[model samples]
Target: MSGLRRKLLIITVLLAAVMELIDTTIVNVALSHMSGNLGATLEDTTWVITSYAIANVIIIPLTSFLTTKLGRRNYYIGSIILFVVCSFMCGSSTTIWTLVFFRFLQGLGGGALLSVSQAVIFELFPKEKQGVASAIFGIGVFIGPTIGPTMGGIITENYSWPLIFYINIPIGIMAATSCYFLLTEPVIKTKVQNVDWTGIALLAIGIGSLQTVLERGQTEDWFATGYITLLTVTAIIALTAFILWELHIEHPVVNLRVFKSKTLSVAAILTFITGIGMFTSIFLTPVIAQRLLGFTPTQTGLLLLPGAIIAILGLMVSGKLLQRGVSPLIIITAGFFCFIFFNWNMFRMDLDTSAYTITLNLIFRALGMAFLTVPLTMLAISSLAPKDIPQGASLNNMMRQLGGSFGISIVNTYSARRVASHRVDLISHITNNNPLTIDRINSYTAYFMLKGIAWDNARLKAMGMIDAAVVKQSTLLSYTDAYFMIGILFAVTLPLLLFVVGGPKITAPKVIVSDH
Candidate 1:
């Protein structure tokens, strides 16, 4: 490919990847509007998000095999078409379930966009420039989700909720068209082998069940619900069996053998931790801003923008350093410490915290992640043969996704339990005879009386208001506690960096062909 054509291809592939990722979080802020418009209860409306997640998790691990089977260029084009068509259908649906189904199809299509885009981008460049390729792809991976909610909020506010999905149609069409013309299929070919059907079934069952339990568990009050219990058991059994089967199977759907590579193993572990911190911080910050601090969706999204910019800078700087022979271990360690500092700062957040404070802390977090993410991608693929790079990348990506799911689930569960515990502690201080309690109640009563409430009614109203205030305070404290918990997790993981096997420093190779 010519220089201009290669650049255009890279731009096209990056756009497609970003489009896929943005869809993952874009619908989040618009869920309420969707529920109301579709005439579905909030709980049922949640399936719209859950369906996409389930499809994404399932399809992600299967991408390597699917690409081999379908041919990369054909598969890439097909996925874009599928995504665009589904987006249109998702927008036009008259009922909630129809939209959910379309979203699932969209997820199936979007799942390949990330993995294939990475592979295509890698193939575009030569061996030595792999670090630069990774840095470029890193932007889409990290920035896409951060930007999703912000862009979604802007679209929903200015237009309508359906426009969020509708907006993808034009972009998807252009990407698909460009991909068909620009993406060249590799000449190398492989024989068709029987796919491990059993492995696929078990994987889908295990991951799908596990994701369902995680996403729905909090809303259903965890183990208190019968369905959650059953799904939990099913997930455990399916996953255990899948692991065993993959170990023994002649041809597994996912190549579990890649984990045997020491570099890949260490990278996977670190990637999982990275996912935990990245996803949890993003997930928790929005809730803190919108729910606790009373920021609008647009305001909350804008607050995160600076961090994303810092992260891009971090990626570029780290990429250049790696190209010059910086040790992966050192860069990763620096990242871990930066991440810990960021979270530690977040632990001090209050209801009145300023946007600049949050933005600054997040920029540190982004820098930390930039140092970590690119080198780890290099570490994971460095030891593998060219044929195995895609498989390794797919597995690494899948683990990160699982880590995010695990982090979200654990954080939500812990936050809920903490709130209850704090609420109990707070309520204990509300003894009827306590002077402070009496004074607080009297002040509330006076406010109610001024609003024309009767004496007995005002007292009851004041007590209820006090109870609500106490609950809010307890929840706020619990959120802060969660931030501290994340900090500790990052701090503890720092020692493990010693074990990662850093490859010998070499100059990055030049680009011979454009994979994009």
Candidate 2:
């Protein structure tokens, strides 16, 4: 490939990957708009998010096999077309279920974009420059989700929510066109092996059940609900069967054997933790700002922009250091500390905190993520044979997604329990015997009575108001407790860095091959 052609291919892949990732978080701000427009309850409308996530997790680990089965170039172009068409359908839908269906289809197409893009980027670079390749790829992975809500807020505010999905049409078409003209299938041919129908079935059952349970567990009140209980059992049975089937199969869909590599094992574990920390923090910060501190969607999005910029700078610096022979372990250590610092700062957040305080803390968070992401990317694929890179990347990526699901579920459950606990504690302090409590209630009742409310009603309203105040305080305390929990998660993981082996010390490989 000529320099110009290579650059174009690289650009195409990166843009496609960014488009997919951006869509993942973009709809977050538009949920309320969607609810009103479609006349669906907030609970039902949440399926819009859950459906897409379920589709994404199911399709991600299947990419490596799917790519080889369909030609790489063909698969890439097809996925883009699927995404574009689904984007149009998603925008044109009149009903909520229609939109959810289209979003799920879009996710099926979008899932491959990230994993395939990572493989292509890695393939484009020589082995010794894998670290640099990871850095380049890291920028898209990190920035896309960060910028997604911002873009969605701008579009939804300036225009409408449908435009958010519609916007992907033109970009997707262009990317597909570029892939057709510029991207090439590897010359090395893979054997036309039997399709692992059983494996695919197991994967779909396992991952789909798992995602549904996680996404709906809180809404359904966990295992107390029959549906949640059923899904949980299904997930366990399907996932266990999937593992056993994959390990025994001649041509496994996901190639579970890749875990045999010690480096890959450690990298996958770390990637899981990184996913938990990254997604959990992202999930919490915006809710904290909007629900507690009263930030607009745009304001919340902009608050994290500075952190994204800092993260980009960290990526560039880390890339340079890796090129100059800095050990991966040291960089990872620095990244771990950066993550811990950000989480620790989050613990200090309160209702009255300023935007600048959160922004500065997020900068450290972004910097920490930049450090872990690139090096872990290197660590995951570094020891694998060239042909196994896709499988390895798929597995790692899937684990990361699962980690995010797990983290979100765990945090939600913890916050709910903590809120109840704190509420009880706070209510105990509001007894009639307490002088301050009595005075506060009396003052509120007097104000209500003066506003033309009957005395009896005013006293009842005052008590209700106090109850609400207690709930709000408890909620804030629960958020703080969750932040501390995340901080401890990162802090504990920092020491595990000593165990990860560094990548090989060598110059760039002269030739690269991709097995299609």
The TM-scores, one per candidate, come to 0.93, 0.93
| lDDT (10s digit) by residue, model 1, range 1-516 | 888888889999999999988887787667667888999986677677668767877888888888888898999899999999999999999999999999999999998898889888888777767776877887788888778878877887678888989889999999988988899875455544898889899999998889889877888988999999999999999999999998897778888898888888888888889988987787778778777787777777777788888888787777777767777787888999998999888888777789889989988988888888888887878888788888899888877777766776678778888999999999999998799999999999999999999999999999999998898889888888888998899888887787774454523322223443
Q: What's model 2's TM-score?
A: 0.93
Cα lDDT, model 2, residue 366: 92
Report backbone clashes per prediction: 4, 0
lDDT tens digits by residue: candidate 2, 39-120: 9986567677667767777888899889999988998899999999999999999999999999999989998898999999
Q: How accurate is candidate 1 locally (lDDT)?
A: 0.83
Span of ten consecutive residues with least summed lDDT in model 2: 507-516
